[model samples]
Target: MKYQTKIIEKPADTLTPVGVYLRIRDQFPESLLLESSDYNSDKNSFTFIVAGLLENFKIDKGVLSVNHQKKSIENTETVKNALKDFIAQIHVRQPDKTKQFNGLYGYTGFEAVKYFEDIRFESKPQKDAIPELNYGFYRFIVAINHFNDNMIILENIPDGETSQIESFKNLVTAQKVPQFHFKANNDETS
Candidate 1:
């Protein structure tokens, strides 16, 4: 699938999955973000979660193997890897220490094309007020934690067409992210 990479940085408090999703929505303006489970959910059961989409990618974190003692780390690394592509879209000050620094893997992908065919009201034919959705990934995603306090940084990894890349740049430049302390990789950063 085609993909776009970015670095997404936010205050540790604001770096939740939902926050990441909202930020991407605000930035991309025309992308459908869905999680792996959501992707599998029935049409009537479809629900949106900020982090759901990112979790679908299941990006590799390069950890040797999953261990029961490191379940949290395993989960974090999974999500972190998922967000790696998302993080590659930002620029920040040098980190004093780093954790989960899977640089360059931060990316979002087009999973499926959605078709908002048509809907009918009770009796009368309803005008298709809803916009037709055909382009973009139906399930592009990124990662975030609801209650993380450690400082994190992600640099934007440029991919996709020049216009697409420039558009993302414009969005980032338009609104500056809240400043947070930078740190190098450490086991506790996630």
Candidate 2:
């Protein structure tokens, strides 16, 4: 995988973690933001704003999506094995780990208990419910360093596209908050 990395240094208190997240939430689909609540704690450090989705795997539903292409997950394969295969397909060759971070963020919960442990908290997929394991394949992420107050936009440019980098830079460097069109964050203060 190829990488196009951009580093932005910001003045302390100029850019709140939520402020950074809001800028891209509307622009990117399947975006997620995470922040540390306590700045003083070492265990809870740094803010991660994950944007863009290259691929998604909804494990519980037995579905895999690559560039919108869908396929059924194998029943015989263990979840871990399926995950390894999925990662191998999209991220077969690991990128250089020299960067601060490079990998997808995911959680294993609820139904996953059946896979690793004998315990059963599992159930069939229901309408409008969270999946057991939903993993996304992202080429990059915005990593904020809480201690130093630096925001870095990281990207793995598999296709060598620089346009998205420029857009991401704009998203992070906007000087002013956009006026809330629907009356939230507006002067009306309803």
Against the reference, the lDDT scores of all candidates come to 0.32, 0.63
In candidate 2, what are the lDDT values of residues 1-190, reduced to their tens digit? 3334444444535788788777877777678787766677554367888888766666555454444566664443555675676667653333354144556666666665555455545366678666666777565577777777766667656655653766677777687666665645546543
After superposition on all C-alphas, the RMSD of every candidate to the true structure, in Å, is 19.5, 5.3
lDDT of 1 by residue, 12-51 (tens): 4434434444456644444443333443333322222221
TM-score of 1: 0.25
Error of 1 at 94 (Å): 24
Q: Poorest 10 consecutive residues of model 2 by lDDT?
A: 91-100
Question: What ranges in model 1 sit over 4 Å off?
Answer: 1-123, 131-135, 138-143, 149-190
